[model samples]
Target: MNEFQRISPQQAQALRQQGAVIVDIRDPQSFAAGHIQGSRHLDNHSLHDFIRNADLDAPLIVSCYHGNSSQGAAAYLVGQGFSQVYSLDGGFELWRATYPDDTAQSPAE
Candidate 1:
């Protein structure tokens, strides 16, 4: 199943209820600026590095500025044997449009 899977913002909310992990692939600076609540910061360029250092069993929800990089990330993770991984359709921009309170911006970045 190498095909890229996209989850609607609505589906994402439902998955979040079951404890899916949201991975914001923006840099630390961008991530600190704002992201989906409870999202972890992981740079796409350093995917393998970060994945090696972090837990891999979790269901990862990859995201980016407009839903491109995260889709790529999800594909890579799936190839790497991550059974459960997904990309948020339309990225954080759509997420914000759908959820205001569920999202928050970082003060520094």
Candidate 2:
């Protein structure tokens, strides 16, 4: 596993307020169901394929369903020259559970 840094929900929320890009690194099918408002979707399963077609200059906040995939995404982003990159501390499940009213369930596949 990579030794990248993670940001807390509150910290993610704060950075989000400043226009950071929350990159939901789940499958497109999962993300289309539900996502943080304005989050960009890029499935972590194929980061190498999807990354080449992404906006790399923005502040990135990567997330998976439970924070696992995000570590890889963060590390990948760092390697691609992303200086301000972070993985959500607990992923989407935690985010939704923590902010119950703030988010909704993802669509079923």
True-structure RMSD, every candidate: 2.2, 3.7
3-105 per-residue lDDT for model 1 (tens digits):
4579988998988888888888877877787899988778647666867875666667888988888888889888787768889999999998989889877
Candidate 2's TM-score reads: 0.77
- lDDT by residue for model 2 (1-109), tens: 2235798878888888988878887887778766776676775456666567656666789988988889887897888877678899889888887776666445565
Candidate 2, poorest ten consecutive residues by summed lDDT = 100-109
Q: Which 10-residue window in model 1 sums to the lowest lDDT?
A: 50-59
**How much is the lDDT of residue 68 in candidate 1?**
88
TM-score, cand. 1? 0.84
